[model samples]
Target: MYAPTPESTGSSVDDRPAVERLRHGDRDALTELYQRHGASVYWNAYGVLRSRPDAEEMTADAFLTLWTRRREVQLYGVSVLPWLIVTVKNLSRNRLRANQRRTADSLDAADPPSARASAEELAALDEAMALVREVVDRLPAVDQEIFRLCLVEELTYKEAAAALGLKHGSVRNRLSRMRTRLQSELGPRS
Candidate 1:
């Protein structure tokens, strides 16, 4: 059986060696550092973005930041985990905000307020449903489901929350955000 030692109990001792190596511009040392704290950084990004590919990219960017900023970083307690987590969070937010900007720009709610679709355009529920699907699909997965349930399906907020294993307030809030996005895209209702 393996036994714990002073070295095995904490990150302080183990991390110092890798940090020292990083100070020397050693790629292997950066790899070691990533292996140690990569999951924490990835989780930080994933928790914010909720997408695997984005999280993976965020993790890589965080480690790259660590390598680029190695000489500038002061490791007060011998671990770079905190710095990595902060980097992950900042990058993830930037990516998410950029995506929102793209979505908002793509919306192009620029038609004159008085403009209206022709009766031929409104001949079928299929057209309206397709439009709703296009807007809702732009949201994140959880938000898409919540909006579909609470709005499209006409489920009560409480019922949707229960069905989706979320709090009532959470369901309500997401629905509110969904409404805001649609309002911005389609303009205020008459």
Candidate 2:
């Protein structure tokens, strides 16, 4: 169910006006544009880049490029959405290529984890993970999504809330309840 969710439904109301000004060369258009598209743009970049730091940088770069080339770029009657999508995609690809080049040049793959752990250690880890998954599966669909985003994808508390269209405090409260339920099911592990 989470895999089928729509990331962006459409443009915002304020964005429409700002995009109009941007099309006409208004300098303040940049602010409006940022307000409208910032989150969506960052999410798109994050999907492709996978690194939070890089996704942030790429989103900024994509907007900066639009601002810098405002004169040269003509919106005509086109919606700003496609232009932004194309720009973010290209920038992400370029960043990915640059990263690949750097990694190739360095040839530095880090050392593997220690291999001395006993079979029981591995089993405990796997069992704990399975227990966590079972607890998550027992949650409602929306709560499952929030839990997955926070725990599996490692999104920040706020970021997971935004991605799932929930309030930050709501996310926290749901997570709290989820943890309590999971702990109850896990029982005392002494």
Say which candidate scores most in TM-score.
Answer: 1
Instruction: Flag clash pairs in model 2.
Output: none
lDDT of 2 by residue, 23-44 (tens): 6778788876776677778888
Off by over 4 Å in 2: 1-9, 12-17, 23-25, 76-78, 108-190
- What is the TM-score of each predicted model, taking all chains together? 0.51, 0.47
RMSD of 2: 13.8
Instruction: Supply the global lDDT for candidate 1.
Output: 0.73
Q: Which stretches of candidate 1 lie over 4 Å from their true place?
A: 1-13, 109-190
| Lowest-sum lDDT 10-residue window in model 2 | 3-12
What is the lDDT for 115 in model 2?
43
TM-score of 1: 0.51
